[model samples]
Structures are given as C-alpha cells and as structure tokens.
Target: MGRKKNQAMSVAETDREFVLGAAARLFRQKGFDKTTVKEIAEACGMLPGSLHYRYPSKESILVDLMRLALEQASGSLSEAIKGECDPLEQVRLGINAHLELLVGGSDKVYVLLFEWRSLHGASRQEMIDLRDRYELLWSAMLKSLSSQGLIRADVDRDLLRLIGLGALNWVATWFNEDGRYTVKDIGDFVWAVIKDGVIKR
Candidate 1:
C-alpha cells in the first residue's frame, strides 16, 4: 500500500510539472492575453477537461508557473549566499544565479517578466510581493557591501537596483548560445561596470 501511494504521488508530481512546462512555452510564444485554456491543454496533448482536473483555469496555470520560477530562483540565491565571506563574491554569485535563470529558463522567465501583469487580484499581488521580497534580498546585500566600504560611497541603492534588474531582465530577448559573449562573460562584464564606472582610469 505504501509503494502504491508513492507511485501515485510521483504521477501527480509529474503531471503538475507537465502542465507548468506546457503553460510556460505557450505563454512565452503567445503572451498571456492571447493564450487560452484550450490552447494550453492542447499544447500538453490533453483535453481541456483533463487539464481542468489539474488547474482550474489558464490564469492558475500561469500563476503556478510563476510560483515555480520564483521558488527555483529563491533557492538558487539562498544556496549561492551560504558560508560566503566576501560581499563582492555574494554579489557575483547572486548576479550569476539570476542570469543563469535567463539563460536556462528563458521561456518561463520571459513569461514571468512580460505576462505577470495579466494575473488578477490576489494572484497578481502574490507575485508582486514575492518579487519585491526578492529585490530586497539583493538590495540588502548591496547595502551591506556599501556599509563595509567595499563598494563606492557614491553608488545609489535605488539606482543600482534599477540598473541591475534592467540589465538582467532583458537578457532572454537577445541571448544566443552561439553568440560571441557567453552568459559568464556577460555577467562578468556587467559586474565590472557595476563595480567600476565607464570612465577610463
């Protein structure tokens, strides 16, 4: 009985993953407004009724996808910060983890960034809260580094946050595996700009 129950649980987990993965692809291709429950269900090779058994609506699927992405990103960031002594190393790890999301989970990341606003009421607010909390995590690290006199005093906290997020968020749009600059190269270049200014010394 225990083995049977475990098999059932595994199947349920696999189905949930399937639904989210299909939803992410559809959302990225069509955007939130254009995608429908029927479309997503078809994309997953399931009927609408079957899809409804897993998710109540298209919006719920998108919300679940967003939740999965955020959870993964939070986990990565947490792991990157563990037992790290240097503030700059923390910053580098955090940025690298974030950029890796763009590189590895581009479809989900793109949908999360562009289609998130389509989520309504409680769902929208929940994602917003999670995103804001994530931002605070990065900002806290930056502030700590500045407090230690590691980063320059002239760095504006809000401006730094904006620049960092803006730079990383759009990475999925233009990033190519065959491109001259790899993700690591891009991350390092961005970090150098953040640490040092554009001016020649």
Candidate 2:
C-alpha cells in the first residue's frame, strides 16, 4: 500500500481543523463543563494522548474555540460593512451580518455564545477581553453614526451598543431553520425597530 495519507495528517492542518470542529460539536452537545478531553479525542477519532499533546487541557480547547468564534463573527461584520459609507445602511448590513451568524456560522461560534461561562481565572478574562475588543468595533461605528447626526442626538450610543447586541444575541436562543421567520426576516425586523426608535428622524 502507498504511504497512508492519514498517517501524516496527525500533525497537519487536517488534524487541527478536525479536532477543533469535533470539539466544537461536543461542546455544544454536552456543554463545555461536562465534556471531557478524552471524549473530544474520541470525537476527533484520535487518541487522547495525541489530543493532550496539542491542547494539554479541556479549557485550552474551549479558549481556542471561543477565539475562533470571535474571529468569525468580527470578520463577518467587518466584511458586511466594508465599502458602505451610508451610516444607516452600514448599521443595517452590520445587523444582518450578526444575525447570519446564528444560522450560517460554525458550531464554535454557537459555543462561544452559550459556553463562555465555562472558563475561569485567566482564561475567563482572556475571553472577556477579546469579547470587549470585538464590541469596540461596533462601538466606534455607532459613535461615528451619532456624531454624523444619523442616530438620534439623545440616544446613548453605549446603551445602544449593549442593548442592541443583547437583542441580537438573544435570537440564537429561539431561532430555528424551520421557524416562521427566515434570517432575512429577523434582520429586517430588527433593523426596522432600530431605525424607528433609535435613528434620528
């Protein structure tokens, strides 16, 4: 037989991708606190020792998953708003980008939303700092909109940032592929609500 392709995959891109994906699924299905490194190894079709060599601990896998999630969400939002100068349209596209993550984004992204409390100590703070950094992307954009008078002068951009994200994140709890609302429908309704209530008339 030719040299086995799978033999070389143990330390390559395939291993990392497969391990992270399997770990993400297990995290979502079993909850991060309950899932074990051995289980993640089994899910990856690799030995626990091999996984331990890469991750060392279960928390290490979680931190990586959350980091991956933040990158995906932030990147999606940034790409959606790129080339758009209209503050109103920028906000609309941004809202759609966020909502899209609930449906189209990876299991790691979902894990980030629901499993973040699993981390403790330095890991928890690291995730928090990264999350805050992601939120600042929106904070800056919102401030720009407010300064341009596109947002209501009385509206608190800080509150809007917090409350807006809360509302968007909440969609993941009830959103379903078979539900009455499509992602676009949810996006449109959310944008409408923001436009009517928050944007300057």
Which candidate has the top score in lDDT? 2
The lDDT values for all models are 0.83, 0.87
Candidate 2, 17-132: lDDT as tens digits: 77889999988888888899999998888899989999989999889878878987899889999999987888899999998887775788789888877889999999999999
Model 2 clash tally, residue pairs? 0
Note the residue pairs that clash in candidate 1: none
lDDT of 1 at 46: 93
In TM-score terms, which candidate is top? 2
Please give the lDDT score at residue 49 for candidate 2. 99
Error of 1 at 30 (Å): 2.5
How much is the lDDT of residue 10 in candidate 2?
Answer: 49
Q: Give the TM-score of candidate 1.
A: 0.84
Task: Please give, for residues 70-163, the per-residue lDDT of candidate 1 as tens digits.
Answer: 8777888889888997878898888898888878855777788888678899999999988888888888888878787777666687788878
Q: Give the Cα error of residue 24 in candidate 1, in Å.
A: 0.9
